[model samples]
Target: MRKEVFVAEQRVPEDLEYDEFDAGALHVLAVREDGVALGTGRLLYGEAAVGRTGGDPSVGSLGRLAVRKDARGLGVGVELVRGIEAAARGLGLAAVDLHAQTSASGFYERLGYAGYGDEFHEAGIAHRAMRRSL
Candidate 1:
């Protein structure tokens, strides 16, 4: 499902979409009434998020957030974000961090995330670091 959105639709390189942390990241999947996946996201905490969170154990890293075009305008993306935040809180995290595509930074800001740091590129798409304190 993530491949469908990230690799196929968004043009993110497959090699960059999947990484070493997948095995330990907490993944969340959104499905339809028929069990067809519509969106997905991942949460990385503790050691998994240390590098991304500036070595802060209390901050979880949220990444690989994707929602199928057919499901856009619906609340799947928001739900996935909320779910990731819940997972972070469950792990005793104080906040959640993410590298948001600059074009989508407003979407995350609407959900309470505040962007920081200079813009950078990941998988060929411009991005900005964003975070929200739980």
Candidate 2:
């Protein structure tokens, strides 16, 4: 799913789409009743999340959120993010942070995430750091 959205559609380098953190992150996948995967996301906590969470142990990093082309606008992305946040809360996390693509920042904002700092580029795409208290 990450490959389909990030690597292929978004043109993010394939190597950068999958990283060391994936090995330790808590992944969430949204599926239909028939078992078709609709979207996916991941939560990174503990030491693995330090870099993304600004060294805050009580926070988790949410990443790799992607929805299949056919599943876009069907609430798949929202559920995937909620699932990741629920997992973070289960781990005792106080908050969740994500690097959202600039174009998608409004979506996160609607979900209660507030953006901070200047915009930055990741994989040649404009992004903003956003956070929400759990």
Candidate 3:
């Protein structure tokens, strides 16, 4: 799923797309009735999320959110994000943070995430830090 959206389509280097954090992160996958995946995301907490969340233990970092091109505009991305946030709350996190692609910031903002800090580039795509309290 990520390979299709990030690595292949978005051109995020495969090596940079998958990281050590994946080992312990809570992953979410949205699938159809027949089991075809529509989207995916992950939640990083505790020590694994320190660097991403500015060392905030109470926050969970959300990453790798990707929805299939055909599945987009059908609410898959929103559901995936909500699923990740639910996982964060289940882990007792006070907030969820994510580095959203600048172009997609509006989508996340509509979901109640507020952007903070300056825009930065990751894998050559501009992004901004965003967060929402659980």
Candidate 4:
């Protein structure tokens, strides 16, 4: 599903889409009543999130968030984020961090995340680092 959104849809390179970090990250999924997956996201905490979270073990890094095209305009994305935050709290994290795609930064900001640092590129797309206290 992440490959569908990051690779096929968004044109992010396949090799870059899946990484060593995936194995240690906590994945969250939003599925349909019929068991079809509508969206997905992941949280990286502890040592796994150090690089993204600025070496802050107390902050879980949220990433790989993707909602299917048909699922847009629905609340699946928001729910997935909330679910990730819940997972972070479960792990005793004090905050959640993410490198959000520039296009979707506003959406995250609306959800109470605040951006920091200048924009940067990853996989050919611009992104901004953001965080929210849990």
Question: What RMSD does each model have against the real structure?
Answer: 0.7, 0.6, 0.6, 0.5
Q: Choose the strongest candidate by lDDT.
A: 4
Off by over 4 Å in 1: none
TM-score for each of the candidates: 0.97, 0.98, 0.98, 0.98
Local accuracy of candidate 2 as per-residue lDDT tens digits, 33-131: 999999999999999999998999999999999999999999999999988999999999999999999999999999999999999999889999999
**What is residue 46's positional error in candidate 3, in angstroms?**
0.4
Report lDDT (Cα) of residue 34, candidate 4.
100
Error of 4 at 52 (Å): 0.8
Q: Tens-digit lDDT track for model 3 on 28-96?
A: 999999999999999999999989999999999999999999999999999999999988988999999
Q: Would you give me the overall lDDT of model 2? A: 0.94
Error of 1 at 7 (Å): 0.9
A best-first ranking of the candidates according to their lDDT comes to: 4, 3, 2, 1
**Per-residue lDDT of 1-134 in model 1, one digit per residue for the tens?**
87898889888889999999999999999999999999999999889999998899999999999999999989999999999999888889999999999989999999999999899988889999999999
- Model 3 stretches astray by more than 4 angstroms: none
Whole-structure CA lDDT of model 4: 0.95
Candidate 4, poorest ten consecutive residues by summed lDDT? 48-57
